[model samples]
Target chain A: MILIGEDLNVMSGEISRVIKEREPGPIQQCVAAQTKNGMDYLDVNVGPVKKDPEGTMEWLINTVQEVTDLPLCLDTTNPLAMEAGLKFCKSKALLNSASGATESMETMLPLAAKYSADVVLSVINDAGLPSDADERAASIMESAAVANELGIANENIWVDPVLLPIGVDQRQVTSYLEFIQMLQDLLPGAKSTCGLSNLSYGAPKELKSLLNRTFLVMIGRYGQHSAIVSGFDRELIRLIRGEVPEMVELIYRAMDEENMDISALPQKELEYVKTVQVLMGKSLYSHSWLEV
Target chain B: MMKYEPPLEKISVNIRETVVGHGEKALKIGGENTLPFHFFEGSLPNPPGLALEILDTEPENWAPSVLEPFEDVVSDPVKWAKKCVEVFGAEMLCLRLLSADPMGKNGSAEEAAEITKIVADAVDVPLIVWGTDMEEKDAQVLTQVARACSGKNLLLAPLVKGNYEEIAKAAMEHGHAIVAQASMDANLTKELNIALCKFFPPEKIVIDPTASALGYGLEYTFSIIEEIKQFGLADKDKMMQMPILCDFGGDCWRTKEAKENREQGILWEAITGITFILAGANLLILRHPEALKLIKEMVV
Candidate 1:
């Protein structure tokens, strides 16, 4: 039931400086806000700052740990950075990845194997990504088999069937769910997860967090553990499921088709948002922007 | 002075469900209700099969045109297959271990066997496991897979001329179907089919005359298929009677027809449509779901 955020990664310019300058202020602020907002873990990724990666990782770990006892999810494609971050953690942490590919399996598994880390194994390998649900399931099975063979218990492995942003592909969420169900069937007790924010990453601001939480709940019903999100707003957590189809379609169009503006569809949006409020029990504010 | 004879009594070839002599599932590839190419309104029974393409690497450099739509799939093959079945309604699935190619991942036999098992258990449908395009390597890789899925009805495919002898022998010992690939030549196809049936038997084989697109080399491919059917109907050679397989989507997508060719690219879709039908391909492997649907409707 713990929610983690994947946004703290230094994949961008601003967060990179914040980590290297040892500016715990912005990060400390992030820690306090995210902790207060009820995030269970803040994924810390410095995006390959080798010159002083360990130093940077130590500072963020110390700063974030100082604020709360919440666990940390180590985020980095670099094995050494992940090692440095894990070295500094106070509590048992989750490894962001240890996928099925030769390189990823080779680089990431030892860390998880050595640390007894609960990790995300992308159902993927050198064969590249699949565009549909069955291949995603195959990737999950492939990953699970790899993990099981490496002596990782089924419970310790979480499969990520990469969710495409709905704005770009509507079947993104559906395909992900299908894979999740297959994992449950194949491994029976395997953990399933995806960063919630990735579901609506490139879109209107308000739509991002709101859609994030919604995606979290849908996949959560099928046993989604640990989504990546940015807020703890009440509207975000009211469990809005009723108007899901409508809101999802609208946002999908806005992001993918650019066909109809929400303002043009007033009666439809209001009636739909009300259904979401009723189903999820979240009190919602319907600005005219969501009208379509 | 040849005497005229009545049309050879049309009869169905029994496609038996063959369990791998070594593994967990069963192999199935033959069930002919009539002579090969006698589509004179006879029921083909089983729907055309689809093989899900898997790359040997992360597919970082896939052709941008084809890669864009399948971006979701390439990132994860298992999920992609599930979507193909649930959403696209695929009949039979092909697991191409493209990554196991020696040049690419140089993937090992053990790795291919492991992946094959995962995909086999992920769905209940029969599988056609392909070698990663290398003779000895494919034989080694598919040998483990064929043994592992022992008793499971799966087909280990693309056993070409040079490679066919060894792979076909393994497939026979392990109880799997062999896809005899030919270079779009009726005579070569007949020769190869005879060579394969000499050891594996016609009932345990399918024929791949080597798919070619509408504009590229499809005309030659079509002639080969038509000729194969003509031999089956007229001369009645038992070896050439194996069901024909076509990698239609792979060929179509690879050629200029399926892609966008603005200048002088006339009859793209229509030509692609006619190629498979004319070849009398029993199981046509296709990529686009829309195209598959259209073809399925046409066949029905």
Candidate 2:
């Protein structure tokens, strides 16, 4: 239940004013609220920030860093912004991406490896958005492979299978679920989360809230350790906050109930090995006994 | 302008022995070279058919137009099916058991069996018995209904994660077809088809991509069905290739358009039929004869 505050730049109507004002209290209050609400990390995004190109992000990044001593996501659409913010960041922050795309491999990955930072790679690439789960898995495997190639350890790479809005395409819900499942299977130990409220954007009035909550509960079961939910719902937050002891129960209740046999998943790809003649087989082995 | 190549194209599928009625044509759900109703290329040996939707009990919430045609026969299952076949000229009957709804009066297995037998004997038209969409109770209800209509070539739906075992056993013993229903998911549809293939043959399986009306989320439904069709044909997935039958006439009639009668019932119904036709439906359950007439003309 570790929350990460999302601060996308294009959103927050008063972002430009914040840049001009450099007001610490409001941003500090923003940080304090999420921290009180159990946020372990406060994500600072200069997202889609191509409009006022100059030192706007540097100011926001420096100001947010001053306000919150907690770790930051250092999120940005602009690679330069990502670099500048990460450079100024105080802690071992989480990098937002380095994808299966060749350009991404050349750029964002090396920084992740060099900094020893956790990376959140989207399950997307130059292959484009996969309309189905199998294709989404392909892109994720590609991203993971690239991360491996960069010598970034497996524990540090998180795969986000791009949560699409169900309002845009209702059929995408299943694809989203399957993609999440694939990520859980593929990355056995990595953070998985999505913006929760996006499912109800344009659905019918009666269905919007109901579907959004239903989607939350379902995705929650699929190994989503983190989520971006409505910050305004204080009662539910208090409800989630009060029952910390019941957290494992509520989350793992069904897993305990069903023992969640994951036999639906295919067998994992076998590792290539060449044995030695002393082993009675010509299997030459390199790292066959995985060094933990 | 859009010249294309379809790899793993579904060659053809044949869902055999779905008897529509005594005199009516065999509902052979199959085509070799295209998706449903691409008549220009594929040899569609059996033209798609329509079924009149009847209920064993009065539905608590139904579109007024749908209930208007069968208000008189709602009390009796035999009378209901008869009225659908005789007065409505329905080539087949889609007997939706509103009684099996968990929230409803909840008809017993014996009562469901008696009703099925009555409907089977009253009108020789083939029956498509659907449960109340409740997993547990539907498994109980359809088990009896399938047995009652045994050897008569009835089609029972939707054995999902909860109820597939019982439905498969009954459908196998009763010589009935199983409808693989997926709720607005192409991947789940593929998996459900896979589950169906475990016990049932391709010819005995009919797929339901769970169609909805055009404006009311039909586009999403259509995309899912199209993906399933593509998987069936292009992937040559023997299980996924089960011919799809969309219950859109049921889907459309229950929506606002059918309920909005301002002397525009025919126009509204025509819009539904045409929309579903374009969206890839192999079978339909419609009430309005005029709507069916318009759809038939468009298909021709």
**Top candidate (TM-score):** 2
DockQ-based class of model 1: incorrect
Docking class of 2: incorrect
**What would the per-residue lDDT of candidate 2 be over residues B1-300, giving only the tens digit for each residue?**
887966543455433424433335335544545766666656566666677777788666666765776778777778878877777677778888777677878778678778877887777777788788889988998899888777877878767867888888898887888787868765456555566666766577777877776657877776776766665666455555666676765555565655787235556666765665565556776656667667777774
What part of the reference interface contacts, as a 0 to 1 fraction, does candidate 1 reproduce?
Answer: 0.00
TM-score of each: 0.45, 0.55
* Per-candidate local distance difference test: 0.64, 0.64
lDDT of 1 by residue, B39-110 (tens): 573545554444444443346533355555456776666766676667767666777887788877777788
Which predicted model would earn the best DockQ?
2
lDDT (Cα, tens digit) per residue for candidate 1, span A1-292 = 5567655767767777877777777777767777776677777766656776677777788988988788888888878888888888888888887777889988787788788788888877778767777887777777777778778888888777887765445445566766665667777777766667676656567656555655565556556765666545545543432335555555334323354543566874544443333223122121211331
